[model samples]
Target: MREAFHEQLDGVFDDLAGICRSVETAVRLATQALLSGDAAIAEQVISADADIDKAKEKIEDTCFQLLSLQQPVAGDLRVVVSALRMVTELERMGDLSVHVAKIARLRVPDIAVPEEVRPTLARMGEVAEDMVCRVEQIITTKDVEAAIELGRADEIMDGLRRQSFAELFADEWAHGVEAAVDIALLGRYYERIADHAVSVANRVVYVVTGDFPVDV
Candidate 1:
């Protein structure tokens, strides 16, 4: 019975990693579409978000089933509990990517990112993709230290967001308020995606060490 339970637990972890990969693809493509003004790619990202959502629901159901049937204790209990929290964070990351893609879709032939703020958004996208890849590693390996180090990546994302804001307020800024608003929101979407990655990593730490980090 214990062997079967462990197998189910492993399946849960595998599903989480799969969802993380989907989110990684979503953010990367969303950034590409945003920068290149490719409405088709943006639409693809938007449509695929539903699969991420469905995967989250399936994982949640599996976690709950494990809790009720297996009654996992101690370390095993922590793994199940942390998986619940981690899935939530991953779902939100997928949603944020969808939000970025929708912004791209709205602009259609014209790119949503303005010239002055393009570099900042571009960097943010790169950082977000890298962080999600690391997240997948942390999830699969259960490396507490790698999970904790993700906080530093979140800090870099925060800095990029600030840089974007500065660009909007610069004296040479020529884009109107609407463009300014889009850039601000885009920066936030990327930053929040990073934040959620950190959250997921912290949950992995909790699964391995039974304690979350002091800093969020």
Candidate 2:
């Protein structure tokens, strides 16, 4: 029975990892579409978000089933509880990516990102992707230290967001108010994605160590 329970637990981990990968793809594609004005890629991201939602539902269902049937205790119970909350964060992260893509689609071929802030936005996306990838690793490996380090990665994302806003509000800014608003929202989406990634990593730490980091 314990073996079967462990198997179900492993399955839960797989589902979480799947959600992470889906979110990563969504964010990356959304960033690309926003930068390059690829409406097709934006459409793909908008459509793919449903799959991420479905993935979240799957994990939620599995976690509940495990709790009802197996009645996991101690560390095992913590794992299941953490999985339930972690999927919520992952789903929100997925939604943020969808928002990014929708902004791209709404603007169509004109591109939502201004030329001056492209590099900053690109770097922000890269950092988010890296942190999300770490989310997958933390799920699989249960490395508490990796989860802790993800906070540092989120700091990088926060810095990029500030930089993006500075560019938007620069004295010589020529993109105009509409573009500035668009990029500002885009920066927020990226920053929120990173925040969610950190949240997911903290869930992992909670599952392993049974104590969430104070900052999270």
Candidate 3:
């Protein structure tokens, strides 16, 4: 019975990891669509959201099955519960990507993102992607220390968000209000993506160390 329970738990982890990868891909594609003014790619990201939703549902169902059948105890219970919470965060991350894609579609002929902000957005995307990847590593390795470090990386994203906002709100770009709003929204989305990644890392920390990260 114990071995069977462990097998089910492993399956749950695999599902969660798959969801995370899908979300990460969506985010990357959305960022590219924004930068390139690719209406088609933006539409693709918007349409692909349903796929992420379905993956989340499957993960949730698997988690429920694990809990119902295994009745996990102590650390095992933590792993099961954390898987559910992690998938919730991953789903939100996927939604944020869709939000960015919507903005890309709205901009249409006149790209919503200004050239000045492109570099910052690219950097933000890189950091957000790295966070998602690292969270997956933490989940697979059960590395509490690595999870904590991933959480700390959120600070870099926060700083970038603030800088981006400052530039957007500055007097020089006053004429581009609509574009500025889009850029600001995009920055917030990327920052929140990192935030959610940190949340997943926290869950991994709890699952492995049996304690929630101190600063979550």
Best by TM-score: 1
Question: Total clashing residue pairs per candidate?
Answer: 0, 0, 0
The C-alpha TM-scores of every prediction are 0.97, 0.96, 0.95
TM-score of predicted structure 1: 0.97
lDDT by residue for model 1 over 1-216, one digit each (tens)?
899999999999999999999999999999999999999999999999999999999999999999999998989988898899889999999999999999999998899988768888999999999999999999999998898889999999999998888889989999899889999999989989998999899888887777889965
After superposition, the stretches of candidate 2 with alpha carbons farther than 4 Å from their true spots are: none
Q: Best candidate, lDDT-wise?
A: 1
For candidate 3, the C-alpha RMSD (Å) to the true structure equals 1.3
Task: Report per-prediction Cα RMSD to one decimal.
Answer: 1.0, 1.1, 1.3
- For model 3, the superposed segments whose C-alpha errors exceed 4 Å read none
Residue 157 error for model 1, in Å?
0.5
Clashing pairs in 1: none
Per-residue lDDT over 9-54 for candidate 3, one digit per residue giving the tens place of the 0 to 100 score: 8888887888888888898889888888899999999999999999
Better of 1 and 3 by lDDT: 1
